[model samples]
Structures are given as structure tokens and as C-alpha cells.
Target: MDYYAPESLSEALDILGRGGVTPLSGGTDFYPALTPGGPRQSLLDITRIAALHGISRQAGGWRIGAATTWSEIARAELPPAFDGLRAAAREVGARQIQNVGTVGGNICNASPAADGVPPLLTLDAEVEIAAAGGTRRMALSGFVTGVRQVALKPGEMVVALHLPDPPETAVGAFRKLGSRAYLVISIAMVAMVLRRDGAGRVDHARIAVGACSPVAQRLGALETALIGARPEEVRVTMANLGALQPIDDVRGSAAYRLDAVREVIARMLREAGDG
Candidate 1:
């Protein structure tokens, strides 16, 4: 297999523009997907590119470099609003996988059970795409078109994730239901960001659910309904969670996932209110 690790973004883009090469970083997903003795493809390793390295604050919010690993995110000194994301980072895989699995790779892999998606959705994350032509940004929600699919066109690659500043008082939580405590794919997962008013009523709420839909989805209707409710008064019904379309699988049944989400959402709201 041909391997090229470019040290600069321009060089990386140039190679990608030529086509017939796969962009690789960390290779946590790539290596696992390879079939032994299969037709070998050339690899364009972008990890050495300086531009895609760390997490930093920009004018609007924060920028997480595409090559930043899950371990970095889990240990970063971020705010309370990032708690859910950090939690997801810690749960991405075992310590070994977390050390090398890039958040960018997680998003680009576009798995329905991806631990990062629900938290990122709640953060309103944006995907920054780079190419030989230039760069562009898109909402995370629209970037992952379906299971194992992304919106990148030819010669395009994700460079970083951009998040807008959220309410200073916002707090986030994440919950996952899996067969085991560690190293298991989620049966269902929920992430939420909550901000309260002076009267202790919810002012801002963003809720997302994963492994229960084609793509993780924000509970827009539920978020709207919780606007004026107190933490203790929060209620989640199957009707409010209409955004998710769960399917029966070996891990869980669609009905069970829906039930689990309601409970998780309720608990997260209560904890957010109490804290």
C-alpha cells in the first residue's frame, strides 16, 4: 500500500485533489475496516499537517483540530457546557482507542451509535471542510447524511469542528445505555445542554439522541416545550421525541430505545436543575 504523510495542509490538499487516495488520521476506524490481502489503496495521512492539531478558542467559540484525539478532548480545560462532550470522549472506547481516535474520524465515520454525535449536536457544532479550492463550513447535523455516510465531495476533507459560544450558565449531561459498562456500542444515548432562568425555570435547552435514528437528531419540539418548565416539572413523552426514528436491532428494540430516552432525558433535566 502506498502511504504519504504530508506535513502541510497545502500539500495534503494537493494530493487529495488528484483523487484515488483515502485521507487517514489516527486510523482507528480505517485499520479496523481493512480486509486482509484485499486490493490495497493509497493512503494520504494528514495527521502530520500542523493546522490540524489542537483545541483552541477562536473569536466566536472554540475550534477543535480534526486530528485532535479523544484523549485530548477528555482532558481539556473546557467549560461546564462541554461536560457532555468530555463525557462522551471518555467513553469513546478503551484507553488505547481514546489515545488515538480522533473526534474528526468519529464524525466522518458517521456511525449511528457514535458517542460523539449526540453531544456535538447539543453543542451546535459545525464541520469545517478544506480543499484545494478553499474551505467551507456546514452544520454537524447536515454533514452526516446517513449511517456510514458523510457529505464530503471529492477532494474535500474535514479540518476542524467549530462551536459557537453558548449561554454562560449552560450545563450539559450525557447518558448512554449499552450492554456493558465499557467498550460496548450504545443501545441508546442522550445528550443535553440546559440553562436556567432567574426563577429556576429552563431558559435554553438542547437535547439530542443517538442510536435511535438514521442520524442523531435534536429534539426540537421537546426543547421548545421545556423552555418554561422547572427541572422537577420536566416531562418527556414519546410524542415529544418524534424526531427520532428508532429501529429494532440485535442490541435493542425500537420501543425499548424510545422508553430509555425518555428516562434519560428526565434524569438529566433533574440533575441539571439541582446543580
Candidate 2:
């Protein structure tokens, strides 16, 4: 196998623009998909590229580099609104996977079950994509088109993810239902962010559900319904969550996943409100 480890993001993007190269971050997903005679001709190791690592606070929000691993996110001291992401980080896999599996890799891979997407979606995060020429920011919701498909062009690489500063009263929660507690793919997962006014009434809310369709989806209808309603009204709004599409797979049936979505969202909203 041909291997090229670029020292900088520009070099890496140039190589990717040349075509026939697969950009690898942590390789947790790439390595497993490799077969004896796979389509990948060359391995572009972006991990050595210093520009694609680390996390920092930006002017309007926070930026997490594409190479930032789940382990790093799990250990970072971030705001309370990021608690859902931190919780999802711990559930990405076992310790071994967490050490090498990156937030960017997970987002790029675009799996419906990707543990990072729901939380990132709830945060209304934007993905920064870089190419040989320049960089562009795209909303996280628009970046993933379908299962295992992203909006990235062949030459573009995800540089970092930017999360806007959450509201002061915002609190969030994440929950996943799987066959077992650890090392199991999620059947259904929910990430919720809720902001309460000084009067303890819900002021704003965002909820995203994952592992139930080709892409994780934000519950916009439910979010809209939560407005002007107290936390006690959340259960009624969540009942309409059956509108989401889920499918039967080896892990679970569509019917079960749909049911779990409503239950999980309700629970997460209640918890976020209570905090």
C-alpha cells in the first residue's frame, strides 16, 4: 500500500486533489473497511498534519480540529451545553476506539449511527472544509447527505468543527439505546438542548435523533412545539416524533427504533429542563 503522511493541511489537500487518495484521520472506520483488494489505491495519512489537531475557543464559538479524537473531547473542560457531546464521546466505542476515533472522522464517515452527529446537530455546529485553494464553512446538518455520504468534494478535507456559543441558560443531555451497555451500535439516540428563562420556563430548544434513518435528524416540529410551553408540555410534543423515518436492520426493527426515539427525546428534554 502506498502511504503519504503530509506535514501540513495544504499538502494533504493537494494530494487529495490529485485523486485516488483516501484521507485518513484516526482510521477507526477506514481500517475496518479495508479488504485485500479494496478500491483505495493510496493512503493519505492526515494525522501527521499538525494543522488538523486540537481544540480552541474562537471569536464566536469553539473550534475542534478534524483530528481531535473522542478521548480529547471526553476529557476537555467545555460548557454545560456540550455535555451531550461529552456523553456521546464516551459512548463512541470502548477505550481503544475512543483513543483513536476522531470527531471529524466520525462526521466525515456520515453513518446514521455516528455517536457524534446528534450532539453536533443539536449544537447547530458548522463544519470547516479546506481544499488547495481556500476554506468554506457548512452547517453540520447540510454536510451529511445520506448514509456514509457527505457533501465534501474529493479534494476537500474537513479542517474543523465550529460550535456557536450556547445560550447562558442552556443545558443539554444525550441518551442512546443499544443492545448492550458497551461496544454496541446504537439503535436509537437522542441529544437535546434546552434553555430556560429566569422564570424556569423553556425559552428555546433543539433536539436531534440518530440511528433511526439514513441520516440523523433534528426534531424541528418538536422544537417548534416546545416554544412557549413549559417543561411539563414536552411529553405531548414528543408524541408526534413518530413522523421520523426509521428502518429495520440487523440491530433493530424500524418499529422499535421509532418507539425508542419518542421515549428518549422525552427523557432528555425532561432532564435538560431539570438541570
Candidate 3:
């Protein structure tokens, strides 16, 4: 019922440290998921905190503030390796949602179909968390524990995402399959970053899939298999996708998701490796 928008990180943390307060950002997900006539909860809006609002260069890579909007990410002049992430940013929702929905909210919500997670997984992103005690960092892969779940401890909040420097030659791509092209929940999605050597053999590969499992998963087997293969020779089999565990849902069947992921991976390989 009560809404508090703090101007500084310290102020926000102070409020968050007290139990029973829900941290709110853009509320793109919060407002929609609210139960009609449910008990009201106090809100601590973090959007006003200046520390959580930009994309800046860090020691070894880039730091994307938690409060950074999808629109900001889509428009930022980032590197080729970030192309997939930027593309995913544009696909987050409608223009209005993109203008307000933030990076932190998307991650904290921990939805399997979240467009941002796949690209971030491929980038080997790290989540930065803040608490009243101190700050800590963890791999994005480990941060999202399951569908609609995360590893945030009580009193802790995600502050930013850190991406390590990717190979200079790396290029990234994202592909999504849904019932509709826009404003639809994905049935299967793939994101990948690839780099070719002078001889045109894949030298680096990072692939991830979303919407087919509890948490978005990195295709470690596929990445390893692609290491010495040419872009045109890339092949993905069930063996290479051992990490996925797609389930049957109203949107699609588990078998359909696996098949769709294979097709999407093929497209992503060509786009990221050939482009």
C-alpha cells in the first residue's frame, strides 16, 4: 500500500533491510501479477537510485546498471559480442514496456522465457548483488536457480550485471520461436556468440537456450563440438543439447521444444558465425 522511492542506494538499502518490503522497479511484471483483492505490501522503488542506472566500462568488461531500461540497452553503442543482447532487448516487450521495464526486474523475476537471460548466459555475465552488509558477485548461470526463482538471499538485491571481455572477433545472434512474432511468450529460444579463426574454423563458441527448461542453460556440449568446425558445418544433435529439459506446456510440447531448439540453434550459428 505504501510506496517509497529513495534517491540514493543507501536509502533504498535501508528500507530493504527492514523486512516485509518488496523492491519495485518498473513494475512491468509486478503490477500485472498482483492478485485482485490480495493483501497489500509496501514497496521500495529503486529506480530513483542513481547508482543503478547506466551502462559503463568496468575493469575487464562492461557494467550494466540494474535499473537500466530495455530501451537503453537496445540503443546503446555496444560491441559486436553484445549484438545478441541488444537484439533481445528490443524483443523484451512493446515499445512502452521497453521504455520502463528494467534489466534487474527481468532477472529477479526469473522467468524461463525471459528474453534477456539467454543472451546474458552466452555472454558469461555476472550478477552484482548489494546488501546492507556489502556487495557480492556471482555467475548469471548460478543466479537463476529455477523458473520464477533466484539465489538472492534475504536483504540482498541485484545491483548490476557485469560482462567479461569477449573475443574481439566474436559476433552474437539470438533466435526465438513463439506462437506469434511479437508480444508472445517464447516456445524455444537460442542465443550464441561465435568467433572464427583465420582458417575459418570456429575458435570460440558460447551457446544458450531459454524457454525450454527451469533455467536458461548454456550448451556446453554444443560449444565444445563447434570449436573446430566450420560455420557451414555446424551440426546440433540431441547429444549436444544434454542440458535442456523442456516440459510440456500449453504453448508447446516437450518434443516440439527440442525440435524447435535444434532449428533455432542452426539459425543462430549461421547468423553469429557467418555474419
What lDDT is reached at residue 214 by model 2?
89
TM-score of each: 0.98, 0.96, 0.98
lDDT per residue (tens digit) for residues 1-275 in model 2? 68999898778888889988888889998888879876756889988877788889989899999999999999999998999999999999899999999999999999989999999999999999998889999999999999899999878889999999999858778899999998999999989888888777777888888998789998888888888777765664335674468989898898888877776766666665666
For model 2 the local lDDT of residue 174 reads 89
Q: lDDT tens string, model 3, 1-275?
A: 78899999988888889878999998999999889899899999999899999999978999999999999999998989899999999888799999999999999999999999999998999999999999999999999998899999888999999999999988888888888888989999988888899888999999999998999999899899898888768788999989999999999999999998998888766665555
Candidate 1 to truth, TM: 0.98
**Model 1 agreement with the true structure over 174-237: per-residue lDDT tens digits:** 8989999889999999999999989999888999999999899999999999999897686788
lDDT of each: 0.93, 0.87, 0.91
Candidate 2 ranges beyond 4 A from true positions: 236-239
Worst 10 residues of 3 by lDDT: 266-275
The clash number for model 3 is: 0
As for candidate 2, its clashing pairs are none
For model 3, name the residue pairs that clash.
Answer: none
RMSD of 1: 0.9
